[model samples]
Target: MKLFKSNEWQRVKKSKAMVIALAVIALIPSLYAVIFLSSLWDTYGHVSNLPVAVVNQDQTATVNGKTENLGQNLTTSLVNGQDWKFTQVSEKTARSGLKSGKYYMTVTIPSDFTKSSGTLLGKSPKTPTIDIQQNGGRSFFAEKITDAAAEKLKNKVSQSLQKVYLENLLKGTKTSQDGFTKAAKGVSQLGTALGKVQTGAGQLQTGTMTLQTGATTLSNGLLQYTGAMGKLTNGSANLVTGNTQLAASLQKIGTGISQGQAANAANISKLNAGFDKVNQGLQQLSQMQVTIDQSQLNSSAASVSSGLSSVDQNVTAVLADPTVQEKMKTDPAFAQQVSDLKSNLTATEKSSQDLKTSSAALNTAVMQQISGLKTQLTTLSTQAITLNNSAKTAIQQLNDSLSQVANVLATQAAPGATNLAQGATTLTNGLGQLNGQSQTLNGGATALSTGTSQLVAAENQLTMALQATQNGSDQLAQSLANGAVKLSVVHTGTKNVQALTNPVKNKSTSLSTIANNGTGMAPYMMSVGLFVGMISFSTAFDFITLGKKPKSGMHWWAEKQTVMATVWSAQAVIMTGLLVLVDSMAPKHILMTFVVALVTAFAFNQFVTMVIVALGKMGSALLLVFMVLQLSASAGTYPIELSNSFFQVIHPFMPMTYSVDAFRQVISIGGLAINDLLVLLALGLVSMVLTWLMYHRKLQADTVLFPKTAEK
Candidate 1:
């Protein structure tokens, strides 16, 4: 304290130059802090002063039948934004303004802007662009500010376009919903029709079974008729033989006139019995023909064929449905299902064709059998009648001939024998024709049986296919109903569309809120000013030159400490006070800010003093270099991580880095950085100790070199 009063205050009190120099040193920090902070007080807020040009050449376009001038709307929005000085100008003027530095950026809206925007809803859409040209050669910060404004303008235009697009999309969605509703109703009706078709398929399947049963019955009947014909054929052969023998016997009797009348009468009675048996067989055949109905069978087959055709048509309709086709494209499983259904329908169609062919053939064969049987019955009946009449005539002739046997034998007996032989030959021929027809009928019956069996198999397959088709239709109806419900449930209101347009929103909260550029930058500026103040003081004041011979190096250190502490404290007060008063910096912890500033000033003073005291002018030059490095490394404007690796590596070592952080914590809403304050204090104490050690070494060297000066 004695050293400070005697050595520092006496010099300042004695000379006006010394007092003015000390005053200038005290106020230097304030000048620097206030001047820099005030200049950057609100850089972004004053961006409206920066000139930018807007060239709107876009014409009108139609969107959804409504005329829109997107370019004009964007121009109006930019003019009203107040973020930038957006001047409406021609393209040539905008370009010249950019070249002449009259504008930092020029935004050009081409004539096709609105047209391209309108194309968003078209099949071939065009992208709308807003051309932004920036003049970076002008003030970099001004160019950067305008660049930001341009980006914001782009965003505003995009939002507007998006809002219109979303509105149109919602309208289109509503239209689609209406169309889907109608389609759903149509699909429901189709489902009902398909249900009826399914019913018909079942009935047709039953009819097929009935037809198959009838075919089996007809086949069995044909087999029985064929066996009967065989028996009849054998009997006809025997009758022919018997009749020939009877005719020969009659001839012999005619020749032998002594033959008895009883024998002739007996042979005539046997012929009468044979004719009655033949007539009975023909009656049985006629009765069998009456039981089988041809028309009914043909009608059932036609009905089944028609039902199969309807089913095929319905299947085709389902496959052709747009909803099903869309599903087929997206869903592999659904595609496979449709493919299987198509295969089943194809098989059902083939079966229907086969059944129709078989039915026609069966009908033809039955008709032939019935007609042939009828004709054969008619011929056989006529022949039987003639034969019966001949037998009775022969009986009457025999009775008449009982009186004249030789003449009766010579005339009527021989003629009766010849007539019997002719009747027998005709009967045999008819039986042979019947037998040949029976074989043909048997073949038809066999074919009909095979076809009916196949038809039954096909009917079962078709029934399964129909069942699958019914299931698919039901699913389709349900899907359409679901889709319609979903479409109805969607909300396409203005608020919802807006929400969709900007799906993500930013919600930010700051732990330490900086009011503006000035407030945020105040800490760095204050720290730099205080550092420069210390450097200035170090350059101006003589810290190493002793005013008097001291008892020890500690005494020299104490004197310089008092002078430095007093001056640094005054600089800290002035700088901090000016930040609050001039720059309007309202720190959260005002007292803490003052305390941090004072400590930072002291830390800087000690560091400067230590280096200057140890190395004199060269140390001052080194501190200047250090201050420059600290400016970049201190993370004042940007984070220390954003700096180069060298700066980042040395950032922790820089006293200003801690000082800036400490100032921010106290100035902003963040809590005080106790660790930073401690670090600053530690740096100051270490520098002070280092200065003391250097002073101690110098005193030792001086004492050795100059014993008389040291002793004084």
Candidate 2:
């Protein structure tokens, strides 16, 4: 208390210079508070004054058949808005303005801006960009302000585009919904058609079963027919053999007669014996049991025809023999006999040809029946077993019919044998004429004549049977071809049904947002105001003045702190008053704002006192340095997260760190100021304790920024 009322006080009270200096000292914090806080108070509000250049070169683009110029729209919006003082310029002008510091930042809208914007629905979508270039040489705050403006412009553009995109997307969605509805209806109709097709397929399946049954029946009938034909063929073959024997006998008679001029009289008895054999063979043929399978009719007839051909060939070869021809010319009776044998042989050959034609017809009929059965089987696909019993029954019926035919054929053979017997008698008479001729030749001639007559009878019978078989085969083939056509319809119907079923389908959301950059940075800048105000307080007042050493360090610290605290209190009051005058502080908590400022001043005063007392003039220099550090590190303007490591490390220990927070809490941002108050007060208490402990030596031996010289 005495120190407070001592020489320093008297000198301060008496000198106008000291009072003016103290007043000026007080003005420093007040001026800083007014200038910094008021400047930043409505920074966002006055951002329209911030210099920014807009270079819009965007050309119009066609989007969904609509012309749009996105970049031009953005520039126009920015120009009309009060957010920034947007200077519309060309690209070259914008660049020059940015470099010359005429504009803090330049936003260049590329020529493809609108084009790229329209590509939102393209296969390769491109994000439209607004290129922002900031002037590095500008004041950091100016640059930051311009950057925020740029960000705001960008967000505005994005929001506008997003709204348009959403509208277009909704329109497209509506169109797609309509298309999908129609497609769904079409698919439903297709499904209904498929259902009808499925019903047809079921009917076709039934028809296929019927076809399977018919195929089995036809197959069985073919089997039975083949058996009958085989029997018939065998019988015909036997008859042919008998006739051949008769023809050979006639030939033998002719040969024997021709050779009568020679001493081949033994041939006459052989020829007569051949005639007996021919008659016996004819009798054997009449009684022979003939059986044939209809399926083998063609092959059997072919065999018969082949045999006839061999007979004809043998006859020709024999006639062509020089010896036989010479004999024929020399013996007139032999020639007559040979001529009769040859005429009989010609008849036999004609019958054979007729038989071959009949056999061919029968063979074609059988093959057609087989083919028809195969077609029906193919149509049946999986239902062949259903017809097993019916096929067997049909086969039995066919077999019975064939048996009846065979019996008829057997009866018919008797007349053929009678004819053959008469032919044989005629042949025997011919052989009598050749009684002294060669027997082998007479036998050959007789056999050929007999074969011709029997062959004629067999051929006529075969022709009738083959005609019947051919009619049945033709009917079967027609039925099977119809069934195949029905199955083809069923197959096509199944394919159509498959195509109707759904084969392809498509599957389809709206993101979170942030406050504008200006709004987001408001709390930080408000906090920065408090820190700048505190730093100004230090610069305004001098704690370490040129003085004599104090006897007691505790009294020295107490007196200095009291004076500093008084000045700081006034400074805080003036600052808060200026804050109110500027209308910067939150009007709702005007009282709290003052209290916060006062508390902040007290804390800041203690900190400055401690630094000066502990470190003398060096302490003041360090405090100034700390003030600069706190500007960045106190997380006042920018986020603490963006601060460097060194500042971050010391942040918790600095009183301005809490002061800024406390000011912001009481001012613009509304939060619990208690924590900041607690931290500030705690830091103050720490500074006080540290000053008490550290100032003892420094107060007794303090140094000023300008030390006085000792008396020379």
Candidate 3:
């Protein structure tokens, strides 16, 4: 064993080409790492440097009487941001840039952007949008970063618009509060007015009842007056007829009085003639007495004195006799004739004396009575004349008055009385109507009172509702004020958020293309290449030389492992230095990357050496097969979970699996996996043990590739 080790070392040290070939063979894995890991070290750090295009087509518009240019503001904000290389371009330019891969994404503001934003107060407002077009053909990550920037811009615009909306709402709340206050006051006044109306309606009902009674009394009085008028009309007609008859009778009485006065004058003249005749007779008789006393008494004094005395006595007696007075009264001519002169003369003297005596009485009684009669007749006549005249005048006046009265009774009074009767009938009907209407009026007044009461109740309810509304408005106003304050805070927060527009800052560590899964595939590819390289190396060279086998299996394994360790260490150190020179290793994990890569190479070499020792050239074929299986289970390009169940089960057993995991931590994420390193070293130790045991068994069994051709 000692001689074989010395021979192998001398052979490698003397052959220049062998040294150069081994050195070049060790650089193979480093080349892969340098190419792949350089760009993946800080791949996302350069995302902000990616270009984006913007097209602003939005115009300015008036929103609530204020001029606004939303698109312009959005454009300015995007241009000022450092998240992306944004530029204001025309629509054509933006489209072309996105298609040609000059820009990762294109953001477009439509012409109606401001117009749509202004419609926020309308019934059905539309959401304003910013169109983002990305070139999916370019780097997917680049497109994603630009899309994120566009989304950020949209959020900023939305926050600013919401601030305006809150301000307007606050103003509206103030106006509504004022209106509610006024409504409350108006409801109070309306309640008072309704109460007054209810009181008035009750009074009106009472007054209507009183009016109904008065109308009834008036109707009765009118009926009585109508009857009186009828009677008065009839009486006027009777008076007219009686006055006409009285006028006629008075005229006749006037004529009779005038005739009686003339008759009375004639009678008085005859009476005076009779009274003169009587006086003449009395004078003659008185003269005769004187003559007889002078002549007849002297001549027949002696013879007739006695006889004459006797004759005087007898004549006195006869004259005094009622029979002679009756005869003389009956025979007025008896005293005018003188046939019995002596006797008659004596008788006449006696009669004369009696006549004179009676005349005196008669004149005293009869003439006085006659004079009184005459005087009375004269007065009566005079009065009758005057009365007749007056009567005629009165009659004329009465006739005139009666004629006028008759005409009045016929024309005026009669018709007036009839009209009064008709009017009374109408008044009766009117009273009946008034009574019914009064009842209806009472019902109406009652209804009015009830309606007014309802109105007052409604007004009171309205007042209460208004008070509640006022309180609600006040609360709403206060809430709006609080919202405004909160909105201000939001506005300030959004403004500050603008500084962090690009939350994901992508940086590129190297100028190398790291496409999809390129970084992930790097560690797997490096592991496979190194493992295959070691396998090919083991086949090309002979490190274990067993000339005399009088050693323990452990001693044989130790000698082979010592040589393999020296070669694998030199290869791992060369590859690690090359990766550092190319800037492939993460700067923070520089030392860890070197250590993991060197360890990974050692582990891979140990496993490949064991497989070759166990089966010679056939073992190389088997190792190749195992390499294929480990590639699938290594979890390099894809996680082990994504592989088939068989691959997942064998993942931990695969030597390259732990190496890939450790390399990823050191190179990409700038970390060290101590557990994976231990696992890899343990796998190496197991492979060494298996290789030693298998080599010992092959030697003991005298196993050779060609048994019949050669024998020891």
TM of each candidate vs. truth: 0.66, 0.47, 0.49
The TM-score ranking, best first, is 1, 3, 2
What C-alpha RMSD separates each model from the true structure?
11.1, 28.5, 54.3
| Candidate 2 whole-model C-alpha lDDT, 0 to 1 | 0.54
Candidate 1 lDDT, tens digit per residue, 1-712? 5645756566556678877887899999988889877988988778888888999999998876889998998898787777888889999999999999998899999999999987765656687998999888878878777767877877887778777776765565565456445544544544454455456546545554554554455445445444544554574566567765765576564444344444344444554554454445434433432333345444544544444444444444445433345558877975775675555445545544554454454445434544553564455445445544543453454345334534544667656766656645765665655555545545544554454465456545545544554554455445445444654655789897788567668999878788888998898999999999988998788887665566577787886666777789999998888888888999999999999998898888888888898788999899889889989999988998787899989999888889989998988966788999999999999988988888888887874243354346
lDDT of each: 0.69, 0.54, 0.55
Give a tens-digit lDDT track for model 3, residues 669-708: 6667798999988877888788778767766776523222
> What's model 3's TM-score?
0.49
Write one digit per residue (lDDT tens) for candidate 2, span 1-712: 6646754465356678767766666666656556655555555566678778889888999976899887877888878877778879988888888888888888889999989887765555687888999976678878767766667676677656655654554344334333323323332333343344335334433433433343333334334433433443453344446664644444343343344323323432343343344334333333332233443444434443444444445445445533346657877875775575466555544544554454456446434543443343333322222232333343344335334434433444444445555544543433333222223232333333343333334344444544543443333233323322322332223333333222123342102121233333333443444444444545544555524445555665665665566676777777667656664444335687677777777777677777665666676678667767767767766667787788789878666677667666655455558998888788778877877666565544554332343111
Model 1 deviation from the true structure expressed as Cα RMSD, one decimal place: 11.1
lDDT of 2 at 228: 35
Q: What lDDT is reached at residue 330 by model 2?
A: 71
Q: State candidate 2's TM-score.
A: 0.47
| Candidate whose lDDT is highest | 1
Instruction: List runs of model 3 lying over 4 Å from the truth.
Output: 1-6, 144-563, 570-599, 614-633, 636-653, 660-678, 698-712
